[model samples]
Target: MTGDPLAPRAAPLHALPPLPPECPLPMPVQALGRGRIANPPRPTTPPNMAWRRFGVIGGVVLLTLVATYQMWWLLRGDGIDVLEGLLLVLFVALFAWIVQAFVGAIAGFVLLLQRRPLRMGMHADGPLPALSTSTALLVPIYNEDPARLMAGVQAMHESLDATGQLARFDVFVLSDSRRPEIQAAEAEAFVALRGRLGANARVHYRLRQDNHERKAGNIADWVRRWGGAWPQFLILDADSVMSGETLVRLAAAMERHEDVALIQTLPVIVNGNTLFARMQQFAGRVYGPVIAYGVAWWHGAESNYWGHNAMVRTRAFAGCAGLPELRGVKPFAGTVLSHDFVEAALMRRGGWALHMIPGLGGSYEEGPPSLTDMLVRDRRWCQGNLQHGAVLPARGLHWVSRWHLMIGIGHYFTAPMWAMLMIVGVSIPLLHAGFSWGHFSLEGFTPTAWWREQDGDRFIAVFVATMFMLLSPKLMGWLATVSDPAMRRGCGGALRVFVGMLLETLLAALMAPVTMWVQSRGVAEVLAGKDSGWEAQRRDDGVLPLRELVRLYGGLTLAGVVAAVAAWMVSPALLAWMSPVVLGLLLSIPIVALGASPAAGRWLRTRGIFLTPEECAPPPVLVRATELRSPGTNGN
Candidate 1:
């Protein structure tokens, strides 16, 4: 019936060769020897980008300084006791984090208001351009649900075929699944996907026996074996889906900008069926753009890369992004966990431009379905980001690259810092009550605000300013949303959008202490040399049994109760001051359970609450993926 099963079919399939067993390309592991890359190529940096960088950094520094001064004035009344000094240090560190985010969000708000199309010779809207070079869509999976994996692949392939760029691209399902049953299921899914797409489809699957370094290693194996065949490659997480138009645009952008090694797209979280997931989806949709745009605008050619939904120049990646095993024991040593950030940093160090286009739509991924799931994932990420402390010192990395690494590290560290701040805050009052140190006074602490009174007024002003900085970013996102007619309509009108924002904010406040505790625990574990081994993420409804929820969050509730009682015994004013943290900790279990509830999610959706554009009016690719993943449709 056939001369060779691996032979290409007539017409469409003939444009690209069948997957080869061995097409060797040298992908030497990059050396960390302390030196800059000799005569590295010059990347084309964005013009006037210095001003943008200065604006973001300057704004952050100025605001942080002002907040620091205010805190100092408020605490300087009694000559700054030991407890007060510790409190001030924590306050300043935490306030700096807040200020940095606020400044970035403000920049994003301005960028969104301008609505200027980002240029690197790539336009988000317009007729699609034809791609000249081949691109391999690399989907790396490990013990994941095969049906969901194949569903995304089929969706993207079908979408790409619609754009007539299918011939220029190939799909590779790279698996690191260790379970024999899961491995077999993956093969079956690949076969089923191929059958559905017909013989002309250029989809292939490979299951590696040795899953060295995990996902990063799987991609590298592909690069060494078959990377020479393609000029570009786009990495997709198991749940990633991108519209055909976006894929073509990314490839064409790479073609146009040869010096650019990577381009990261803003992936909107979709298909969240749990309340927790929905909250995450809504926040990401509403506030994500401004935050992303602000970073992208200022970052320019030195932007960071997320792990997936990004296109990369194969040669640049092979040459510059080769990762070496860190020489250490367990968690902080060996294979890089958060490879995307490190890869981008390395590529940029080699003088290749890395950019993120947050304005470019059509990229999507799903969120962890529950708070528990989120915490588990965050633990692994926490370790990975903390490991970046090692890479930060690598020679020749741009200051911005170092900043990105620090930001990643800080993302985890701040959790502990916030938790410590609350702890210190609670302890201060507890100590005063326990040791009989007498009542505190705010007599001479006046740093007069333009329209405030002396003592307590200064305290009120400082507190208000801190809260304002914390909440202003959300307000900016809400403003941006209401201003856009299409977005507003998609998010269930300006009223529902505002309602959704408020609900999300309230829920977040209640969840804040719980999150802080979990992250603090994660940081502590990683620091204590515990490794977060690879585990497949839960994709279905995340509702857990009441007992399970209790087991997970009981300690937090007990802590909250003790803190509340202690504060109450001390003074009612102290209790009031600590209520937010105490309340959140007290309700941790219910807050997490509510987040994991699919019933609650659906109930809210019925009322147009927590709506995102993807849910309201999905792109065709997402719509197709849903159809293919229906119970009877997928080959499973």
Candidate 2:
């Protein structure tokens, strides 16, 4: 068995070798102490970044003020009632979130049009830079597919070797898997990977007996054992893949900038094989850039980490980025679930600069193959983000860092807020016992006479304005895409790109209510102290059995039907107003089922609808990964 490389391996291949001896590098659990580190190291930030921040924040506030005033006037004809007051409150809160994104997209659109680097001193367009210091590529995974995981690593290994920088970097696969058979497969896969790469391969594998903090704990374990050997390390998700050139430039940037602690690259979604995945891939490919550029422009050196596709200074991370056990119960207590935001905050608190570079290409990852699969992942994310509430008030966090944490928390709350708004809006007609606004003439009641006279035009105006703020990002992203000849061609021309955007928008509208309902439930559960335990993600065409789909979405469909009947009974106008949300809920089962159909995805791809640039012309690294990703291929 030892002599022949092709010989079949036994059960020992299911388990990793004895744990490696510790090369201890102290990573003390940081206290959520008061105030920024005393005498924090001040790193240089981009010029005019403060102005950029002012412009973005100022724009959001101004737009919100104007919108809120109009809404107040619309409902103030007879003074706001309780339900009206609640509606107005939700509108302002949700509208502010929309306006912030709109303003940021505008900033990103301008930056993209300028065709300049997003971050200062970052050169992404020229020759690949050479690396002087050694870097480690750390991929932390748990209970993921062995074949797919090893294939991506092999592809990255080959890409780096082609860059002549293979000697300057090492790859580490840190596993937190608990199953004996799965661990065996992981070990066998790695053994095969090393054999295929020959004797000089620098890849290493380690398994943790304890899974304390899940992914965060796995990485901390690595930092304690071997982090001192490398000056910088790149964190990669199991699905993450980057070009050799992008990896080299990231390392070179760290070497050139001594004070910078981390650099984040925007990982574009690729390899989408289902309709839902394709929609996500197209959106991220077409619209994601502008958003990233906008955030990075204002975020400056105080940027955030997305957990992966980011390189961090080993010393800085070891010295300042240790995560503390959040003091709380169940969901919020124990290990911080959303560790990335807190880690970035702590690093920033220690005065280490963190930056996001979006223009530099080559970073890529896959999207959830279907909505059902996506929601499973989102459930965990929802819990993780909700847990950040406990971290938001930690002493000395930069205000921007606090904003980032708040954004994460709000991401989940907005769902319930949305659902509540719809529920309350529909409940108004029912509360009156009929559609007659003239039913009540008491003081502190809605002004039915005034509403009857001016409601049509005012309603139209508010609706139009809200839709504009919500959908302008898609328009801006499309315009930016079509303007670039190469991108336009890659996306199957300008007309197809336009059509794709419309199709994606329609599907998104149909799916939004379902998402809101599910996320609303998820938020409630998290608040009620429910934990989203770890589960392997579905990475393929997510088609499910009809029974399963019904089991998942039956209640939502029933709720939609009941809501529609109630709205139609009250007034056709109310039904019309609630159609978008009701229709989505009513059709949740079919919509989800269709979204998981590989055939539906293929049909769209064949028609040139929802075609992303990556689909039209995949990069070399992605092409290689696909070539090696099959089960029996690449010695797996």
Candidate 1 structure quality by residue, lDDT tens digits, 431-491:
5434353653332221122114325666677779889989999999999998998899999
How does candidate 2 fare on TM-score? 0.94
Alpha carbon lDDT of each predicted model: 0.85, 0.85
Model 2 Cα lDDT, one tens digit per residue, 1-636? 459888666436445434435666888888785656533444558888768899989988998888888778877876789998998899899999999999999989998888885454667667778788999999999999987898899889989999988999999999999988788888888887877888768788887899988999999989989887889999999999999888998998899888889999999999888889999999998999889988988998899999999989998899887888888788878888778998999998888899999998899999899999999999999999998988888898888989999999999999999887766665553554343556422222332333444466766677788889899999999999998888899999999999999999999999998899889999989889999999988888699999999999999999999988866655566667678888999999999988988899999999999887787788888988998986566542
Scored by TM-score, the top model is 2
lDDT of 2: 0.85
The runs of at least 3 residues in candidate 2 whose Cα sits more than 4 Å from the true structure, single-residue gaps closed, are 1-7, 11-22, 35-44, 429-457
- The per-candidate count of clashes, in order, stands at 0, 2
